[model samples]
Target: MTGTALDAATTELLAGSLRELLASVSAGGELGPALDALGWAEVLADDPATATTLLFTEHGRALVSSRALDDVLLAELDPALPPAAGSRALLYPHPAEGADPAPLDGPLWGVLLGPLHGVDEVVVPATAEGRTVLVTVAATDLAAAGGPATGFDLGSTWHTVAGPRPPGSGPPAPEAWTRAVAAGRRALAAEMIGVCESALTLATAHTTDRVQYGRPIASFQAVRHRLAEAYVAVTAARAVLDAAWTAAGGADGGGWAAAAAKLQAGRAQAQVMRHAVQVCGAMGLSQESELHRHVTRAAALDALLGGHMALAESAGAALLAGADVHPVVEL
Candidate 1:
């Protein structure tokens, strides 16, 4: 099935299950067992006819689920895991400090960098002689030798994984890496859409209940306009993500589509979350409010896989290079 045609029932079921699983984990529960019980890893491991749909649905749900349960689930349910043969693999440029490189380490180290919270293992790519190889690294091994201490923040846990890598699959075509990065960009865009939606929901609910000057703040024309603007931005972001998701399934030049999707989604997420916080006023900034989490997470997501500006530049370069820039959604 195409990414756009993903069964709503199945999507809802997966979302609900993930939400419940994460809730249980957040309430002083073990994460690994919970995921294992839910067969999450197995589902990711299962080869699908349409990788785009699976990745988009699962990544989107994970983000939405994380909004309710917090960012702890971000790394645990990484859509990039369960590295498969012929699939795209992300390549890192350097090793984390204090971590030893693998025997086959090339000039560029294969690693996963950024807000890696609860991520046990990550897939890395290495290219040589026109072929790319995939490798997996465990988080524990990364920091085992006293590398940069793992740390957490309002948005996510920032950690760097490095060291010896376990061989994943045999080398694939060079283009496979590009495809994998594009798919990842699409998944990240999907997650950003969820973050924006969650922030908008919070802003809408807060304005509706908060009374100011004997009237609900939501009743004020200014507040209403702000919310309306945020809603439109979120909707636009979703549309871009949907188009990118569909394109990622099989469309030619999917990488360009994914880049555009990420650029637009990142902009929407940043704008919506900021407006959401402002609509909530001082309380939104308080630690007690969930709005802050959404804001911080959105900021972090926007920066992931290079920020919106970088993606925009990439897309522009591609267009200049004669890549077709057609609308994925036809009116």
Candidate 2:
């Protein structure tokens, strides 16, 4: 086989792995052990001396261990609450002399977090084996500790759950999770491609079946143009995603390529979903119809990694500054 063939094969394998890993994350399975076995864990794990770049909110804060550097004693607790009448309000509740923890349990976590993030909400269960905890870390406090008040390191917190040693035994190397995430993103982007195509197909089918004054609606110039645009957008998005996936297979420059893929895919997915909704008109928005479900899933997945515009801007800036814009994997 040639070099290009080898690269394509590697990408296919990585994409498959990514799809499976995403299914696992959604199914609530841990990947730490699997990653540790890959021999790349040390490279992926957090370095206390050097901070890592991450996609967290501007006012992010972390809850560190009070007992140990890795313990869950000090958690980053954000009390997500509903929007108050006539204004936005943040309920930063301090523990009363005898505050009960029961009120903290249940759907309230999700309820409070929903409005803050402006995305589909979820409440990670608080089970013994391992669960997400809420910690209240003040910006001032964090600043006083000699660091910016912006990003956080969740990997640091993972140490507490598994103790000084990392979790898992003989398994894939640590870098596996990074590769897995990249691959997973690519697969999801591919699924979005499938979704856009299906939506266009549905619209075309409807136009063909529904008659206007004297002929099929598909004969209308406006309908034809709309479908043509949808086709272009979906196809372009798919191409970017495929190229990004191929780039992600190599160890050299996968990060930038993955970013580009994510950015392009997200915008394309959103545009395609909106176009689908417009083409279907009232029927598309119906709760009973499967079209809306596909649209919703596409919109949701777009933000699964990060904002498309931001990624695009970053990619553009890097390019303008003469940074390497080529795909990392040599194919």
Candidate 3:
């Protein structure tokens, strides 16, 4: 959902509170109850744009993971989803084989890019008889079919399970799936914005404090230019994402927003990671530094959903198919 454009004062106020909450969240604090206490449900219902951007961006900035992506996807694509009850996750098609579908009476192969603390079932998107469909799989079945799959995110889970779909959910609803994927892309772009921002922040701090020739390396022109380039990339990507949300309901069923957001963010992620790693130098790999953690998360996000190559191809194909995606940044 495109966020309701709240006044700047209100947005700032919400950002301040969200910043505090996410700080605690990254330090290993409970989130669900606190979110409910903060009227998260109301905010999500009333101002989803604010909720999506502020919450997910803060999540990425803190290097924390949650079921927020699941929330965004279900909101747009939940016609066939389960009733809000116990724990559940909507697993995306595995990036390696994004279009693969679960064979009828068989299992689903997908990637679940989050924690598996108390999840009960995973809803996987698959194709049946040339129609995109959702298939429900028990978490226990995921465990039985195969243990965790290899991935950059240690907390992430792999889905290869089988289960019964709630009656009516098995029917093909390609439109809903399309909308869900679009929502997923936007949510991911927001997260990447945070990721790139954090990486830049860390690099900026590191570079400023780093000494060379009895002077702060950040004072050097070359270092300054490198960081400047990184900053521009982050800003441009952020602007693109903002513009996309403004046209959330675009031609081609709004697929252009999704594609454009993902493409720009993917480019920014690559640029930010490269610049951060270069600036941080050997310290980037050290356990004492936080840069590595952000780097790993960036890499994982880059792979998840789609990397640059895949995203570019998909975007080109979308444009070729007559999808309009010219998002004009107003400010």
Question: For model 3, how does the per-residue alpha-carbon lDDT over 122-219 read when each residue is reduced to its tens digit?
Answer: 67677777788776666655655434554555433333333443333465768877777777777788888898899999999999999989999889
Better of 1 and 2 by TM-score: 1
Tell me model 3's lDDT, rounded to 2 decimals.
Answer: 0.71
Q: For candidate 2, lDDT tens digit of each residue in 1-331?
A: 1122224454345335433443343111233344344332332233211101110100011111111110011111112322222212111111121111112232121111112222122212221222222223222222221221112221111110101211112222224323433543454455556556666777788778878798987788777777888888877776776567456536632556666666766777677667667767677778665676566545544544445765677668877888555543463
Compared with the true structure, what per-residue lDDT tens digits does model 1 show for residues 176-253?
A: 445655655666676777777777778888999999899999999888898899888878876786677556555443
Which stretches of candidate 2 lie above 4 Å from their native place? 1-181, 327-331
Question: Rank by lDDT, descending?
Answer: 3, 1, 2
Leading candidate by TM-score: 3
The residue-level lDDT of candidate 1 at 2 comes to: 22
**Candidate closer to the true structure by lDDT (higher is better), 2 or 3:** 3
The candidate with the higher lDDT, 1 or 2, is 1
TM-score of model number 3: 0.87
Q: CA shift at 63, candidate 1, in angstroms?
A: 6.0
Q: After aligning candidate 2 to the native by TM-score, how far in Å is the CA of 177 from where it should be? A: 6.3
Report how far residue 78 has shifted in candidate 1, in Å: 15
- For all candidates in order, the CA lDDT equals 0.57, 0.41, 0.71
